[model samples]
Target: MKAIYHILNLCSFDVTNKCLIAEVWCPVNDLAALRGALEQGSRKSGANIPSFVNRIPSNGTPPTLLRTNKFTSGFQNIVDAYGVGSYREVNPAPYTVVTFPFLFAVMFGDLGHGVIMVLFALWMVLCEKDPKVKRNRNEVWRLFFEGRYMILMMGLFSIYTGLIYNECFSKPLNIFSSGWSVRAMFTELQWTNETLSTNSLLTLDPNVTGVFNGPYPFGIDPIWNMASNRLTFLNSYKMKMSVILGVLHMTFGVVLGVFNHLHFRQKFNLYLVFLPELLFLLCLFGYLGFMILYKWLAFSVRDSRTAPSVLVHFINMFLMKGSGEPALYPGQMVVQVLLLMIALLSVPVLLLGNPIYLYWLHHGARNQGTYRGYERVQRGSVEDLSVTLSQDMEEGFALGDVLLHQAIHTIEYCLGCISNSASYLRLWALSLAHAQLSEVLWDMVMRLGFRGDTGVGAVLLALVFSLFAVLTVSILLLMEGLSAFLHALRLHWVEFQNKFYSGTGIKFIPFSFSLLQSGLDQDVLIGEV
Candidate 1:
């Protein structure tokens, strides 16, 4: 009764690694019924519809939704993971567009270019579902149609960013400047003459000193009053900006790392091990500031005791400890001196730094300890993984290694950010380039003296000029756009995935045929009429 009951409840069967072929143990009398039930069950439930490569068996009792077949022997590392929850049947259309788009836009916001991208995304989404759009069928259409929700979300994000950036079309600042109705609504910050700097022509006049400053048109020169004079050290000095952005970006990554490490509590490690690298950034900068402050005070011959905020200064100098550890062993000092120096340096690092780091680290670590420990055991222990060797596994990677993997990931993300952000500089560069290229083309046409009522020679010349301009613009867009997309993808693949993924786990598969044919199967037996 127990054996029959187990067989009856079986939803699916999957072959494991090619070496482990499923034997299908059963009484001779039931074999036909079982095979028939399996086939029917598979068809009814759409089991194995989108099958994954099979490997080892899954961890739990197979759900009724999907199944896998076992194999006798084959490739190493092949595995399957399946989603069996009925809740997945809920429609993905409504939320998908909003979710992914918003997330992406929050990350990659820019106003003027977003409108075009959104329109393009929308057109692709709409045309993808239309079989009539293309003369020949395209497999790529499936990606667009199926991913419509994500694309839609992306578009909405683009639109939102566009509003924030105050840009639209090829020349946003210029076009938006003239919209009298929208302009009237925002009373707090009016779009005055200053906003019209988009296409301002360069001028040599002493009065026109700013980057985009040009000849003024009489009364309302908005550019003159705008905050163009404010120095943006990073924006003006791109390498410096890269360093600042890199540090901030790294800090964000480290914060995520801390959470991950905490959530997967490993044994015998300091809370500091899991702390995000970023928490130290401000501390490091403060230490630098302290050095500068100390130097200035010393040079000025000001009494250290009487200096303004003497206590704060003392804290900055004596207690400063930001760059991970104190700068111990500048050269080989004697043991006592080394200890003394570390004690001296550590006042800031240990006293001020360690306490704060410990507090936050403890907060995150405590909750993560249990859950993370369970995962570590199930995943074959991080330490055991580090030294484990397998013929099929990647050459350099070991089982339990996390730090090296994370470091590579950090580099990848940093590079990706740098590359992706660098790509956007093209937006500013191309917009200006496009305007200049058009102006040059128009000037050539004007110089040709092709009157509205013209002869054949002049008409031919005008047509040739127009063709050249079109070809030139088309080439620029195609080549430049292609380069940007490739660079962007490189960043995405390297930077983002490195931090959070192993992408090496086996997926689950199950078998459902026997369950389907038998009227007594669990799904049919338990499901609603």
Candidate 2:
């Protein structure tokens, strides 16, 4: 009743025959159904004249709308939370369904923690349509219930990443055949309990026969748990993965920009803007990503110390300094020089190309027969009139303005390429922090229980276990999960989507009889959008 009243208040009356006149916005594709519904309503009212829906051209920009079902609605809302995509432009929501959770999992990975999240999300999905659950209107739970599918995917991917991380509640899982031979060390030393060496840091060289077969086929090898240098191994592995994954994610975004240019029929942008952006990104950051992988393949554990610093090489490339580091591969210096030149060259093209193209196009239009539908004459009073209009058009697109716009865009792309790449390091930082925090809980709380032996110890163990469970769920799972979720959101919005998204389009708000008949609160309708 309230919706109907509000809608009626918004419409005006047709004074001619005392009929109501309402201007409603709707999609072109749904015109047939809308027409049918109007005709049906007219027939039911016993009106002699049929309803009319005349098509009128609108100067206002139409709202952006993407069709979504229950499964996709969650992902769409996630994208919308940042800002709505432009009309008829590229949609990022479909891709977000996969990327969003995978990125979250990279930070939130832990088999036990993931399993707990999965159970919570799974329950929400199962109880989605239940009346009792729906009636419960807690804002936080409602938000969670609406995005239950996203949570489910996040949990599932976390389990996969957890398997790769080989962590379950801060302890390494020995699910697969461990590549390291810990028992072999004991036998090689040939020591009884009395003759045990005081040295706690016995290094197991991978090159030593029978000591290491290979890395565990799945996750990190369990040998790292006992190794003193596990931090070095994990840090290098996670950081490298972060750069590779981040570069890939950003590159995919820039490729999407090409499609946007193609759709809009802007050859200038396709040739001048996106091309240079892609080149500049690949030449510099792409080279960095390539170097990271090359180091792993070129160097083995025995001679790893001899491997050069990737960061120092990258810095020196920018400074144009020849530090004379040993070549990792053939033609290394030549490759670096070429890459740097290409990247530097792309900046000038991006800065000047678009403005120059626009200048040529604007001037060339003055002599053309038809220049944007404004007729021009070489002589007579028409020439003076046409000159006035042409001048107006030219003034609207000033050369200085075009140049300034292009310059800002060029600088943004060049700088964003560097900063966004660095932003991905958050993945490594979060993963390490989560792992360390979980480890602390186990060592500080659970370790006490295991060390005790008497009756008081049994009672103490139970209390300690309770505390561990509370902290793990409340702090690690809930708090850390939320933190990862927000960071993932930032990555998608600022780092990934910024390559393509403009978010200038308004949102679609179509009126429907179903909405009126459903008797839903205004808040419910708002939430749906």
Top model number, TM-score: 2
Off by over 4 Å in 1: 1-114, 133-136, 139-249, 267-270, 280-478, 507-529
Instruction: Please name the candidate that would achieve the greatest lDDT relative to the true structure.
Output: 2
Candidate 2 TM-score to native? 0.90
Model 1 weakest 10-residue run by lDDT: 71-80
Instruction: At residue 90, give the lDDT of candidate 2.
Output: 81
Q: For candidate 2, lDDT tens digit of each residue in 1-529?
A: 7666656766678888777777767888998998999999999999976786878886445678798987899999888887777667788998999999999999999999999989999898889889999788899888888888889999999999999999999999887867877677667756456545676556665676777778789888886898888999899999999999999999999998877776655656777888899999999999999999989998998889999889888888888776677777787778889999998998999899887766655567645743453323221210012223456466554768667777877888889988999999999999999999999999988898887799998999999999999999999988999999999999999999889877656678666767655645544442322
TM-score of 1: 0.41
Model 1, residue 58: distance off in Å is: 6.6
Candidate 1 lDDT by residue in tens digits, 96-134? 223324434433343534554567667865675466764
List TM-scores for all candidates, in order. Answer: 0.41, 0.90
RMSD of each: 15.6, 5.8
The all-Cα superposition gives candidate 2 an RMSD in Å to the true structure of 5.8
